[model samples]
Target: MAFSSPELNFHKNIGFLAFLPLKTKTSISLISGKVVALEILYRMVYNSLTAFGGQHHERIRYEQSLADAKKAGLRKGLYLGISQAFVNISLYGAVALIFWYGPYLARIECWNYDAGVVMIIFTSCLFATNSISMFIPYIVAFIDAAVAGAKVFAVIDRKSPIDYTNHTNNQPHVVRGDIELRNVTFNYPARKEKKPVNYLLFSFYIIHLESL
Candidate 1:
């Protein structure tokens, strides 16, 4: 079957998307979206460092392709550093606020010191427990397996023009004899009207051998 250039390119890109740094991004997104809300921000900070290597590679490749490659690299690095700094500041700042305000509130309201401490500890533990749900290693593995299986099945399910495996009477059987080539026309599937040099030469040689 004939395929347009865009269709072929889309298929090629879709095939490679599964092999890209998707799992890492998914994990990081899960952690940041869920765990950050629970105040268990340290895990995300650690995970971010691990994920940065993949981003670094992507940034290097992308920046190097630009007209002002060095400037692009510098801009990317500065933006990343600033963003990471903000994240760190926000995480620690929230913790500091909790500790500082918790004591003040406890003293002013005549609440027990131990209760305030327990509240902070309990909140942290609650988020820590919830964060465990984000470690979906099995889910990622299953998704990868499913994608690979789909690709494999697509090829297997496709009907080839020439079925060598068919053993029925309707199928032609190969005999242990020399095959003859005559005035036959050959064209590639994509370009039916154009006779490529290699195909023309191959066809010519086959026809010449048959004549001899």
Candidate 2:
């Protein structure tokens, strides 16, 4: 099957990418089921390299990862603390300003509003300010969601270098021929000291039949 154009194929691919997360989740569950066996093999490898202390490299990497995790945690905590502090300050400052100005307005008769009206406005402002603080706890979650969304969209938006749907060139639909290799020999460069493997000759002929 072939698409009408590259853009149509691209759209079809974008539709396919929508199911990528589900595919990834299934793959992750399958991998998780094999984690125990994989861990056993990993431990065996680590044990085999104990004589040369190759395992120490892994230990160092683990320690470094732990340290990075701690640093990230600390940074997140700092951001949360600063944001909460700012929110609290803003909330209290608004309350203080309203209380101080409400009485001053009444005393000076600057506005025609009474005590009841003042209280209503004050309560509304208080509720609105408090609502902002409620979102502080979810700041980190929002950041993580934004980052994940960027990664997903990045993969979807990326362009492939080769357009396989383009068949303008003289490409054969069905190839029929004999494949022959004559005196082909090769060996790994690392094993140059050893004897080279030789392939003296080989041939594979195609057998085509006409429709009866």
The most accurate candidate by lDDT is 2
* Model 1: number of backbone collisions: 0
- Steric clash pairs (candidate 1): none
In candidate 2, what residue range of length 10 has the lowest lDDT sum? 1-10
Can you write out model 1's per-residue Cα lDDT over 112-207, one digit (the tens) per residue? 655657486647744543343233223345545664576579999998877768776375465544444455566543244465533222233323
What lDDT is reached at residue 145 by model 1?
69
| lDDT of candidate 2 at residue 187, scale 0 to 100 | 66
Please give each candidate's TM-score. Answer: 0.29, 0.55
Best candidate according to TM-score: 2
For each candidate in turn, give its C-alpha RMSD to the true structure in angstroms: 20.2, 15.1
lDDT of each: 0.45, 0.57
Show model 1 residue runs off by greater than 4 Å.
1-72, 114-212
